[model samples]
Target: MKNNLTKMMALDIYVSNLEEEKYSEITTELQPSSKKSVNLISWGIQDLFFEKELFNDLDTIKTFSKNFNWKDNVSTVIKENYYESLVLTDAEKKIIWVSNGFTKMTGYEKEFALNKTPRFLQGKETKETTKKRIQKKLQLGKPFKDVIINYRKDQSTYKCELHIIPLHNSSNSKITHFLALEKEAV
Candidate 1:
């Protein structure tokens, strides 16, 4: 048991270092060649393995929220609804992060969803009125809950319940990001 624990600790440290390196690479501007190298490293097998293992862990999620300087309310919402698939977006509505459950629920990989708007999940069957309502709510910078038909990567439709919260920068009280806790509506 002690040996196993030691191995686990070592693996955790290695993964942590890799995550820091990836974050550094992402934040730093790089030449095209360096960017390609970073992409290769970012999408390597170990990244996939560790991200899958770590993302579902509640403690890891809490640490992630804190590390990214998310507001208390944002962290609370995330902690309370951790079981639900989470989609976090920049103020512009571009996806910045997603829980592993999001991929499981939508059949879309994290890489595919990153930097894209949640509208990618909508299809012809999605109501225009509902979309407009969601946009308006977002514009108002308020938390709201709504249900809409959303398509998966395979184009299958599902009724998705979205609890959307606009996060603010605690220092400035300005909108920083949006968090959506989502689940399939039965």
Candidate 2:
């Protein structure tokens, strides 16, 4: 148990350092500090991994991990380089959340994406078979993985690897939302 805790703490420290380095290089306007000091102790950093501070202050690290809008900090840095994007859509297929990675990948701003169906990301080159497969899976509330050509805001197309899962309500087990994760073709 002690060994495991040590390993976990080491991994947390490593990840915290990497995130800090990434955060420093990302857009300054969007950077979010982890949190105030009070929150860190209150949240019990020792319970997280270690009693020692990670890359940043204990409070900052705690806030960032537990309280802050991690999506914003991660979204900006991740999209500019990494190929990952997350999308959340209602059962009706209207967009609810489109990660910043999606914006960077497709050039469609969040404001433009809200309430919009992902079909807007398709263009002339998009495969009909892939679209139909995606549609069928969603209609059946099935998780799906596929590779398809997708269009960006500039009308340029890129090959995308897509994975989608259905989010279900706990009580009735009815599908409530869809989560899509897409990675750029490498």
Candidate 3:
């Protein structure tokens, strides 16, 4: 219970950080109604009293995202932190989401990356073993972690510590999405 409460608090902080970054980017003042619609300030507070537990596990968060449209918030957090996040289209295995971290790290914007395969980030220096291991884990619908050489939009190479987690519809035991979390290996 205590752990869950801590996670809940952390999520609050996380949301605040994201809101700070998001609002910073907007120069115009929105009308009162528009602000209420665009931001979740009051909604977040109101929903804090819900009956559900508040643990921040990846799966639990994914479930909330699926049910309540928190998916945008999830990716926005990654974008705000300049941390790479990619969501594959479950079975089809195409890019469905790419965070701004792609832009900060690779110079590729969300508009250009969506609908493209993640392989676009790979180049000659990307090792065969790394690719194969990722593929194997993905095929097994299991979480995978590895360091891989990835290329930017400029085609420059950098080592990335990649963590790919299979997001499942736990009730049905079916993979609904994959989350690719990455950090600079430097």
Output the number of the lDDT-best candidate. 1
Residue range 1-186, candidate 1, lDDT tens digits: 567645644543333335456857754442234343223555577456544544465464466556656664554665555234788898899998888878989999999999999999999999999899889978988776777899999999998878888877656778878888887765
Q: List the residue pairs that clash in candidate 2.
A: 34-64
**Clash totals, every prediction:** 0, 1, 0
- Pick by TM-score: which candidate is best? 1
Mind giving the per-residue lDDT tens digits that candidate 2 earns over 74-180? 32332233235667787898987766667878888989999988889888888899789778867877565666788888898987866666766545667767767
How high is the lDDT of residue 165 in model 3?
65
The lDDT of model 3 is 0.60
Quantify all predictions' global Cα lDDT against the true fold: 0.74, 0.62, 0.60
Segments in model 3 whose C-alpha atoms lie over 4 Å from true places: 1-64, 67-89
**Compared with the true structure, what per-residue lDDT tens digits does model 3 show for residues 46-158?**
34522222222244445556864322444344333323444444456687765445577778887887788888889999999979977887898765556679898888898
Ranked by TM-score, top first: 1, 3, 2
